[model samples]
Target: MFRISPFIFILIFLTACTLPFNQPILTEGATVPRPQNAATAPVEEQTEPPTAIPDTQTQPTDIQNDTTNGATTDNLEELANTTPADRDQVALVEALTGNDLPEFARTEPLDVQVGDTETFWVSDILNDSNYEVDARLRYAGPHVLMYFETAVDDQIRQEDIDRAAQEFEERIYPRNRALFGEELSPGVDGDTRLTILNITLQGAGGYFSSADSVVQEVNRFSNEREMFVVGLNSFPVGESSYGSVLAHEFQHMIHWHEQRRGPAWFNEGLSTLAEDLNDFGDDNTTILHIQNPDIQLTTWSNNAAQTGQHYGTSQLFMRYVYEQYAQDGGLAQLIQDDAGNNLAAFATMAQQTRPDINSFADIVADWAVANLVNNPSIDDGRYAYSLLPETTTPVDLELNTINDINQFGADYLTLPTGTTTLTFDGSDTVSLTGATPNSGQYAWWSNRGDDSVSTLTRSFDLRDLTQATLQFSLWHEIEYNWDYGYVAVSTDSGETWTTLEGQTTTKEDPQGNNAGTYGLTGISGKPGIETDQGEVGQWIEEQMDLTPFVGQEIQVRFWLIQDDAYNANGMLIDDVRIPELDYVDDFEEADESWEGQGFVRTTGTLPQQWTLRLVKEVGSETIVESVETNEAGQANISVNDGETGVLVVVASTPYTTQTATYTIQSETR
Candidate 1:
């Protein structure tokens, strides 16, 4: 294992731990770097556009002609003599104009001719704290990530970082579709490029990703850009409810569509509205249930309430006013009504929405009162109280050699006896990429002798077997001659065998029916078994029900008797196993006594509650003891279940808690 920083290693280890069982199981593009790591949910909504083009008045352009024959030489001389300090100022101007800057001191030189690219006076290097960068959109070529750094430390909060991302997605590039309604290209230079790094909360100000995992943040004046920042300090770590913080910032980008900029109320209120309210007639409002401080809904923040509530309630207040007063155009209309103005007129317009502006204040007061008994539970669809019984350690059975059975691989299994090694390879087709070789052999074979028996005994347990499965492998070349294989079971070691299964395959004529004579079959052929090249690397998976064979200790054996030498060439085996229930049966195995009966059973409600039916065969019966389950979804108990005449349990509410009893049932016939 490579050494990683504490943060990186922790994340990596968690990733591996949580991969085996993922909540809301992910599909496609999901990577599990380690266990115990929660999988990230896919972005359900775009939330915001990629980037917002600055809305500014256009300026007329003027150009001077280079009339002199020596003008080109003059320009080169002037450019070469420019000082580094002069170039910095020029670069700053270029940034504002969204134009490329020329090569200057403190920067690498550009080889292209001056005519191909524009120039700007470079300014001070932008640092991390003072500014932020929206590096999510720019993923291609050199200098794709814009830098925004300040001298101030601890300026970049996690929430601010997340908000910046959401705003860019919802405001700028709405989706992968081009402005002209064309599909975006796959690469970064293309329109629909995606940023590898999602969000960072490190010491750096600007964000840049050289690859999917690495990021670099720097604080320099020259790095300053119009980057968005979010503040995550308002919420607790691991608490997902504060997702509205993202929605709030996203509205900033959306509001920019109507008004280029505005006061904190208009921007903040509208952004807040994205959390609890929406006027677009779309259900884009964030869906979150807040607990505590439940007052009549009003625009007020509670210290005790979670972070999401503060921002969400703020947005809800703004939305309530907009919906009540403005019907025709609403907020959108109000923004368009302003000729590049601020929220000063908002108070007046808000009067139309709420005649009693003070009503919201009362609502907030009511919320404070309601906070006393406001403890509500929440379900976010991704978690549950008790999922499944946790397995502390893996099953103790020796996977390398089950019951002395040895030699198994993805494609082939071999059992060595005498001079020849019997091989059964499952030419199973591959479903997952890079999992196992699809063309190789897969099999499990054992030739271990039981110390107490003379004949070779092969105990087999197969769970899923089905009809139409004639034990065929795709790698076997010969046509269907599969009738030669036979399956048998023996009770007393392998002394006597009872034929249980057999399969046969035939080569039918292309037209369907068998040829007129025996060997004259041009299309139809008799069922025969073959082990040619074709059937060596294929596997057949089937579902079999083995309810009839219980109690009787059985040993299974498969013999591929060859009718023709060609039938002895290839064979593949797969999904080959006799499955046993969670509880092992008592038969020849010693110490099959009642091991202090495990008093755990399943129970449900009246109509669906499980009834425990105990049947006595011989000997005596004893009711040992009973225990109650303390865990959630555990059960309580009742002594009887009507006609079943055994132990019964009344199902509990919330479908929780169960109880079980240990009882020994026997009879003297």
Candidate 2:
């Protein structure tokens, strides 16, 4: 006796379709005599021959004695009892009434011979076998044959079949054909039929079974080979999900026949594309690709860890390429091209669509850039879509108070005893003199406490300056035995310092001898060192030449130091100055001789540090050429070539800014 094992049960659920007879559904957990060739038999052996039963035949009352030709109903009870209870009753009804069976099943069974093979009725084998009938339904237009272990009427209705057929014909088929530019063929037996079996599909919505010869058969009606069989989950799934799965599997079938096979990424990517193309929109599973762009396209693995990203990125890449370069029938061309393999197919498509892009590497690079900088206004045709607007410009720095010290990138520190502050002392103010009014705020009293120190440090660029100077007003009260003050400068941005000569001082004691480490190395001076002890005395003007630091960037620091013994009122500093040279150029005079001279002057009373640059404006971009000034703040810039150009002379320092533009013509002296 022929027997269907559990594995075959699953295989049948994947590929079996309705013919013109009632197929005997194998029992769920029944032991029967296994066929001699059960292990080695081909798929055809598992499928019984077609059956024929007349419509006039009523439901049989006596099951045991009912026999027709070599077929007997003796095992009906055994078949019913062995199958699942829900399916057992339905199988018994099909066996008895033959009402819901196909029209072809109503005819007498025929032994049609084709190529020396005899075709027997499927019912003939059922009568002699111990299997039972489950549920079955026939759907025509997308030619679906649905089977389930539950009753057919209970599990699926004709309307469900109609909906499936309508979706496949109206949406899935047209979209897939349009994408691939190829006609879908029937299976090996000349039938474009889809056997949609209801089974427990683990971790999937549905699957296409390619191993079945029936699926691979040639369709006699369309005269094309069948694609494959579809297996759907037995549980209820919404029409949208069903439609998406149908389209997805159909794309797989189309791809299978088009190129035999390709890389998993391409295969899955195209199928996902088909799903969205069918108007199902992208499901949650595929959107992950865009969310995670780090995954490489070609190296996407289909395992559990990467399944979502792999599918998503693949679809994204394919869609990106399609929208950007292959709006024409390039994707279809890619599908049909016989490039031997997936990479070769891609290469061929890339070559035909974008000859400039050499390989997938270049495509990936451009794709990554598009994902990152998706600004269309500045895109220059690189990105396909714009994602964000332009970024905001940074605010310019302003000089206001000592708190605005940040403008010059300077820092003030009062260690162990005092805090740096900007305040006016009653007797002294820098603004009353030559200092800018905003610069009148003096560096007030430092720590009078023992072992205290105070510092004011700032850095400036003097690369283009011919001359510079540091000058300030100071008042101090220091005990001759313990405290002093000084000024220092560093060329290497304050990593080290060199104190200027004649800048340090200390008050004298009653004996008229300076006892502290005053006027030592690395010390500038104590300004009011001659004042009486404990007196915040007269302010003194001080100057330090900065010409040595010209043409170099440097930092200057002010220091107030106190010894471990007695400390008097500390120090006060105002009108601290690092003069930057300002440029005054006579372009008209220079143009007459192809030479321009500019004078740099101190913005205040002291010489300053400044940079001079000649900028040529070409379209929207400005190119800077450095110009050096002489000790007299004179910059003689020559434009030798005889061409009209827009030139800008810009001079800037940590303390001042000036700009001059000239529209000069080429003229000989």
Candidate 3:
């Protein structure tokens, strides 16, 4: 007689559209399985096919007579008796269901009330030590791209998947350190194990507090087990960008170990703060990258129905608090005070320590007014030509590793407390360089846009750039510590310039100190291609399309805004380049409708060659964006639901384009 294990059944059942969402529920007293030490190692290749044939010699004699459900009276007896053997088997099953248990020292079973909360204990069907370790590392290894054979519905792409994983790691890493201090190490105990599985899009992740249902979902499977599985043809980012997501998830594992529950703000905010890009030395000075609260902050504040208020606002608010308390080592104090507090108490503490905490809405308004304004220091007279709009000091450009040192100088950048410098050996290829602890600074370009005319000596061009990349190294002092300056660029040769994304930053907020250095720095320069653009956030290596500007005279300018009146601390910029494009555009224009009262279609054949951009003017941050057009020449966009905004339309062809505008209502919902 042949018998199939539950694990294989689970993998096959959940592969299609619907995943099992219902299962036996429990509260506490469930036994989760302990993991082995060897699980964290790299997975060795499996040369043999994964199949098991039952040991016929060990089979029970009555198996043929009671083959139904593959259970005999003896088997039923063991389950009913709760004997040691039976209990052990049960424990294994529970363990398999929940993936792995947290470390023993930090967690102990407690009597949970049925009405208040539910618990899961699935230890009955444990993956044998060898099996779990062997499969886990193989699936989770950094080099291997773990994905599904056939794509899942709305499945995330490899780039997005890698980014998601990296972002998760970034948020998790620092929280673990701050929460556990120095005691936390990933993959040390069975507690930190992760299960990446190939569940359908709807059932991929676990619920807020549904461990029991998760157990049942895990149990209803057979064939091929992955602690974590990619469903149908998934790939990871290239080796060059591997660690971000892994670090993120690992941090979650660490946080999950703690038995205490805190508010979502504290849990996620700290996680956002704790996310590190892994580029710092012992001395704590950054080498290449700095933390970006903007991503976390911005995403959190988008209040549309689909907008998430937790991460973005929390990250920004936490950053604000960190800036206020960082100097006095008040970060730990603030976190501790807010840890167990209820929402009101937490809000009170936040108000007292940082800003008022009416809600994320208030925070977004304040942030936009204070930081998003177009406060460029340079005026019209400052550029190489009189035609360009004025900009602030601090010129922006794309800088590469080699060219940065020469242009920005070595003094501007700092090595973390214990980080080493990158080096290029005789072979002429760059390697991660090592060095003693150090911090440095640079005094690069300032935007002449805000200054009196400076004659152009030469204009930056990208005609020779093919198969090359553009990157920039930049930094912002802790919030309000704005002693430093920044850089900007003009693709139109300084006639008119746009603020480089992430051109400026407020100091670190009071609650946290500076986020340590990171890799994956950004460029202050805009891409040569009009379609390929850059925005505010961490540094990036974006490709440029030099095709449009080839042989066309291009102007470039840099700025150095040194006004410390508003912020005493300084900013830094280094490196520049023009890189080749890696991806082609799949330009799909969506059908769009505006629900606002004042925004209706105008008559005039909709001017064929006009630029229609969605401009969201939030305080100082006015984002002027052009919408993609369809074959019918229709474009679509929407503003923040409650905020009134104007959509700017310009017709530049046939003659010098004239501008028109339409206002958006606060909310239609």
Count of residue pairs whose backbone atoms collide, per candidate: 117, 37, 144
TM-scores for every candidate against the unseen true structure: 0.22, 0.37, 0.26
- On TM-score, the leading prediction is 2
C-alpha lDDT (0 to 100) for residue 617 of candidate 2:
31
Tens-digit lDDT string for candidate 1 (1-669): 000112322333345333221111111001101111001111122222112211221221221111112111112122222211111222222321233433222222223321132111111111101222333221122211212222221344545444544543554334211111211122212222232222332311112111111101110122212122222223222233233333333344334333432322234445444443322221111122122112212111111122233233334344444444443346665555431122224445655644433322222222221121121221111111111112111122111231211010001111121222111111111111011111122221111000000011245343432211112111121223111222445566554444332112222222111111011100011112222211222222222223344455556443222110011112222233343433322111212231111110111111111111111111233221122333222333222211111121112111111111121222211
Count backbone clashes in candidate 2: 37
What tens-digit string does per-residue lDDT give for candidate 3 at 229-287?
A: 22121113342223322332333333333412233334444434443323210111110
> Which regions of candidate 2 deviate over 4 angstroms?
1-135, 142-153, 181-184, 213-238, 299-302, 338-344, 351-353, 376-382, 385-669
- Candidate 1 steric clashes: 117
Candidate lDDT (C-alpha), each: 0.24, 0.37, 0.25
In model 1, the worst 10-residue window by lDDT is 446-455
- Angstrom error of the Cα, residue 617, model 3: value is 16
